[model samples]
Target: MINVVGFRYCRLGTADLEETVKFGTDMIGLETVGRENGSVYMRGDDRDHNICYFEGDPTDHTLGLELADFDALDAAESTLTTAGLDVHRGTGEEATARRCMGYINFKDPSGNSIDLTVRPFAAGRRYFPGRDAGIDEFSHIGLRVTDPREAEKFWSEVFNFKTSDWIGWSALMTFDEVHHRFALFPSDRPGIQHINFQVSETDDVMRSNYFLRDHQVRIQAGPGRHSLSGARFLYFYGPDEMIYEYSCGVRMVDDTWRARQFPVNDASFCAWGSKPDLSVLEGPDAAE
Candidate 1:
């Protein structure tokens, strides 16, 4: 097993870096920390950065995960190679670009880029948001996969991710279990489906619901509670139609948690009956 130790950061390519960075600060309430080489670093909580946006194709996305140390990273590279996936050991300059001590990058079975790193940098200063959105930390993400079953098996077997729950074939998986680190959503293409930040309370979720609406940002779904994780959430579309979420009061599990399956439907997605296009969550197989 790869033994993932942290769900750290995302490197996303945006069509216009300036616009995306402005939207992130003015609308979504992220703090801009630094900029270099056309990449803008941002964070919701105090780590070096949580997401980096660069000017490039909007479809390009990479998720960064932390390993225990260089030994674990070495083991991960060997494991991925033995499994027949090509792995690139990151150069020192590339590791500096990723804000890590050492790293390797590879594509998952579904072609989503993943960076496994050791000694990711942390900030000495605390985070201060551009807006008081009550953001607590950068949390989970939704990863798009071509096949849910295959993706589930690959993550659960090849790495330490374990399923916390499922809506249809899609799995809410975690390594350290703050509910889920990756919410696997089946799609025709591979990329990050959504980025999530945990806010302080339900009021944060509801407040952002109106705040985003007044700002002319498109509301994607929810000021509703999720049935699976028991968190109140608000999702909105930012630049390039990328989804960002703020949620609070998520359930946490230990070894005692039992994974349960829920059919793809309105209640499975939300407890308060706010209908998001359920097809977006379940993908092409929703109507089958």
Candidate 2:
């Protein structure tokens, strides 16, 4: 099994780089850290960067995972190759672009781009947001998968990601103590379903609701508590049709915690009587 440590960063392609930058800074409250070539780097915490928007096709997306060290990264590459998966080592220029010492790129079973990186850089200074969304950290991500059962097995067997809970075909998984760092939702296509950032408290969720509404950013879902993770959340749309989430009060699990399963339904998603925009969860069909 690959000893995956945690999620590092996400790289997304945008048609309008400046518009995405503005949405990230002015709407999502991320701090713009660097802009070079055709890419804009933004941060939500001490990490050198948590998100990068580069000029390319909007369909391009890459999720990065940090390994323990060079040895661990090497082990991961060997493991993936042995398992009959194609792994590509990042070039020196590519490593420099990602702000990492080394990295290897591959695709998950669901076809989402995965970058296993070594020595991802962190900022020396604290993060300052353009707006006060009270973001604490870039928390987790929701990945759309064609077959959740097979996807869940792949993640568990390959990377040893533990299942924390399951709502229908959606599997909530964790790499460490935090309840879930990755989730797989059933869909016909493969892509990021949503990117989540944890806020300081429920007040932050409420504030962002009004703040996003005032700015006329389309509110897709939330301002409700999730039954699965016990987090209060708000979901909204951003540039390139990407979904962004602000959540707080997520429950944590440890070695003693047992994984639970729930039937896929509205109640399993939200306990506070707020229906999430189903299109965001299941893809575009529910919306129509």
Candidate 3:
């Protein structure tokens, strides 16, 4: 099993960098950490830059997750190569693009570009949010997998991601169970379903709830708690129709415990209040 550390960041290509940066930092509670030419790097409370946007057509979407060290990265390359998966060592430009010391880029079975980084850059300065949003860290991501079973096998067998729970065939995979660090669900499109940032309190959720709506940002779902992770959450649409989630007070798994999977059910998906009504069906920007 490849001992993965945690999520690093995601790269998105957008035609409007200025608008994207404004929306991410102002509304989403991420801090603008770095910039190089046409690319912008945004970081959560953690080390690695959590999100990046590059000047291009909006079609380019990629996610990066970190391995423990160079050895873990090397082992992943070997495993992928032996498995007949095409892997490319990131070059000068590619490494710079990733903002990591070293990296190898490969596609998951669903054609989503998954980047494995050895040493992702950690910012030296302290994080201070421009607003009062209580975003603590870039917690997890949801991906749209065309086939959840195949995606589950690829992440579990190849990458060592253990399953936490499932909604139907949708599998939530994690390195350590703060519920899940990544989730995969069957969908027609090949990209991120949503990006989540953990906040400090329930009040933060309430505040952002009104803040988002007042700012003309569309609320996609939630202002409620989830039955799975048990974290209070609020979901809304950000730039590019990307779903952004704010959640907090999640349960953690301990050393002696073994991972368990939960079958998908309506009650399990939501705890109290209404089940979320998402405008986007199962694809990128889908509600008509």
Best by TM-score: 1
Q: Which candidate, 1 or 3, would have the higher TM-score against the true structure?
A: 1
Winning model by lDDT: 1
Tens digits of per-residue lDDT for model 3, 1-288: 677787888898877899989988889877888899888988768665788899986757899988889888888899889888899999878888788888898888888888998888877787877577898988898887777788888888987688876655677778875778887856876888888989999999989999999999998777888877789889998777778899998777655546555544445656876577632323322211
Ranking by TM-score: 1, 2, 3
**What's the lDDT for candidate 3?**
0.80
Candidate 2 C-alpha lDDT tens digits along 1-288:
887886889999999998899999899999999989889999888899999889999889899889999999889999999988899999999998899999999988778899999999888899999899999999899888777788888899999799999876678999898889988877777778789999999999999999999999998887899898999999999988898999999999998889898865678789998986554344233312
Residue-level lDDT tens digits of model 1 in 62-178:
999999998999999999999999999999999999999999999998899999999999999999998999999999999999888889899999999999999987899999869
Q: Candidate 1: count the clashes.
A: 0
Q: What RMSD value applies to candidate 1?
A: 1.4
> By summed lDDT, which 10 consecutive residues of candidate 3 come out lowest?
279-288
Query: Higher-lDDT candidate among 1 and 2?
Result: 1
Question: Each model's RMSD to truth, in Å?
Answer: 1.4, 2.6, 3.4
- In model 1, what lDDT does residue 106 have? 99
Predicted structure 3, TM vs. truth = 0.91
Please say which candidate is ahead in lDDT: 2 or 3.
2
- Give the C-alpha lDDT of model 2: 0.88
Error of 2 at 186 (Å): 1.4
- TM-score against truth, every candidate: 0.98, 0.96, 0.91
